[model samples]
Target chain A: MKISNKKQTLAFLKKHFIMQLATSYKDKPAVAVMLYAVDNNFNIYFATHKDSQKSQNLLKNPNASLSIWEHHSALIQASGVVSVVKDAKEQSKIMDRLADAATEDESFWPPVFRIKGDEYIIFKISLSWARILDLEQDTIRQKDTPFTELNFK
Target chain B: MSETKKALIILNDSDPVLGRVCKNKFKKQAGWDTILSSTYDEAIKIIVQKKPGFLITDIILKNSVKDGLDLLKFIRESDDKDIAKMPVIVFTDLGQEPDKKRAFDLGANEYLVKTELRIADVIKRIEKFIS
Candidate 1:
């Protein structure tokens, strides 16, 4: 598929449920595989326990990067400032979106929902910049630059 | 009669007029009922009991040991998931970057500087979230 524009990018994001999130604090970096939801504005949302390393890192430093990829098909790399979505209404909305994006198997449920005692914090990554690599189209070899930059700022 | 959602306003006693005006404006413009609290402790109690649909609070509270930021932290850390996740808007006179950062860091949904924005602008910002 020709994922060139904002609409196409949003479509691509909505089709995927999992992403690799990268966070850092005090020169130390950490990455976690997370189930995420993307909104119309292309902001990414995910929930993690407050005590988790990524959450601790984000609390101290909100800057982060994330990537979503499919085997030999396409790749999206983006970075943004993360903020906790504290509003109850907004949190519920994001959870609904996440539920929709979850795997289709009826018996499967994300582990985030199964954990009972830990408090989960919903974080929003308001994308400042993004780029797409359309491998199926082989734009990298044919074009001068492989990355099609997306501007959300 | 149709049910009206409630918006809790946490303010200090220094300016009763501001709180009253905001209450009336929110009610008239957004059709939301208003609940007012004067301190962090009072706000927390009202939050647990009333479960208001929205919250607007000031950073400083007169005659109260704890201020709005403490209240915000409490709400975000509440054992009850619903209260912990409740929408909170910090409407205050503190416009400094550090203060704003602190509020957002503590999980405030919106931070409005009282001196920077007009009352109408504040109401509009609140309506955007609740509406």
Candidate 2:
């Protein structure tokens, strides 16, 4: 569904945790399931291994999109410019937020997967536009509602 | 290092724009992960699970199932001190004397009229309670 009101949009964004972040570099495109923390401007922050393919892709081409949903429905799809968060203080803040959100058990599995040290790259997606799609709703409503644009600078 | 905290915002309207603005204000100004819950059930669920650092809510929610007052009652009457004492700031257009009195009676830490304050001012008030 096309949602223009800020209240509903923010509600949808805050309710979810994971976002399918898609990035493209040259002819290759990649998508990764990431735990993200979004700021007021709809800028998304997530951590990944520095050597990860997504990181390499973003380096070459910053254009990206994110597909976020709840219970397999109410999808909020967004397109944005992506870049690594290089500021030390901002990096620490995002890393700490990620660490707080991560499960303790996740730490035991892969150290590289966790948001720790300089080994991980923190990527920030500055949203250009976004839209909502609710497949669970009726076809008429889905068809009538246009994609709501999220034009945040 | 200080632990990152979350805040819960309860509203009756399901407007996406306001939701984003509220979340952005709380997240950017106060550095709190703002969770927006449109329904009473959703609000209660997040309150219990997240134990948000604080709460900002509108009094008159369209959802008749349970309004913001019911949520306040739940928080105040809960046996959990953390939940019961969690700072609550009422942010709504309902600004009658009785409404304010009732909210205070229900243990609202602060009350703000939607018209009297700008969004920035609302966030400023929230910062006081959370920070």
Candidate 3:
């Protein structure tokens, strides 16, 4: 799907609900799977504990990159900053939409979802640029070895 | 805890197949081997003794520390300086911003989402530090 705006892009993400969150400092990169759910404003949010590394990182550095896509049709990739949510009302709404994803029987479910208190980090991406590439059309030309030319910021 | 190698490696996943696959791929460029520990305490012991080239730990350490993040804190506070430089190469299913920043903040050498790379790809990455 071609993304004309952030709303369209996030709409694509809402369909899949799974995303890879990439955060970095200096030269190192960190990636994690997130059960990403979008808000009315196309803002992305996910549940996480207060003690999580991602939370601490957000404290030190707010800038982040979030990629949400499916292999079947398209890939949704975007970069932005992450903010921690302290509001209880906001947290509850995002959690309810992701009821199925938060369950125990899923393939990639996180146990932290079962815990309470509704602590989480709401990642809002101010993407410099984004690309929604279809798998069939986007044949990666740089596929020599798996990690080759694979650069992360 | 005692370790024969310069680095200490830890993994939370108890799958037997994964341990073997990681070991086989690492044997070449690593020169040393990944020590399999299901818990954080066992990981600490090996780290104290072997002092291997590096620590390729999993994000969540089983039985002992709740997560690899805690074990990371343990290594930083250890008596040995070698353990300090022992770059943590996180090869886990857990990959996210906060965890990544925490790993880097805690001084991980590198962090790779397992879904992003295979055993062979990970071994190639380790070779960079070794060389």
Question: Highest lDDT among the candidates is held by which one?
Answer: 1
Candidate 3 stretches greater than 4 Å from native: A1-153, B1-7, B28-31
Candidate that beats the other on TM-score, 1 or 2, i.e. the better one: 1
- Work out candidate 2's RMSD over C-alphas: 18.9
Query: For model 1, what is the C-alpha lDDT against the true structure?
Result: 0.80
Candidate 3 chain B worst ten-residue window by lDDT: B13-22
Predicted candidate 1 versus true structure: per-residue lDDT over A6-117, tens digit per residue:
9999998988889999999998999998889888988999988788889999999999999999876679999999999999888767755665555333333455533433
- For each candidate in turn, the interface RMSD (Å) is 18.2, 14.0, 15.4
- lDDT (tens digit, per residue) of candidate 2 on B57-89: 887666557789888999999999999999988
* Displacement of the residue A100 alpha carbon in candidate 3, Å: 39
Q: What DockQ does model 1 achieve?
A: 0.02
**Judged by DockQ cut-offs, is candidate 3 incorrect, acceptable, medium or high?**
incorrect
lDDT of 3: 0.61
Candidate rank order under lDDT: 1, 2, 3
Chain A TM-score, candidate 3? 0.68
Q: What is the DockQ of candidate 2?
A: 0.02
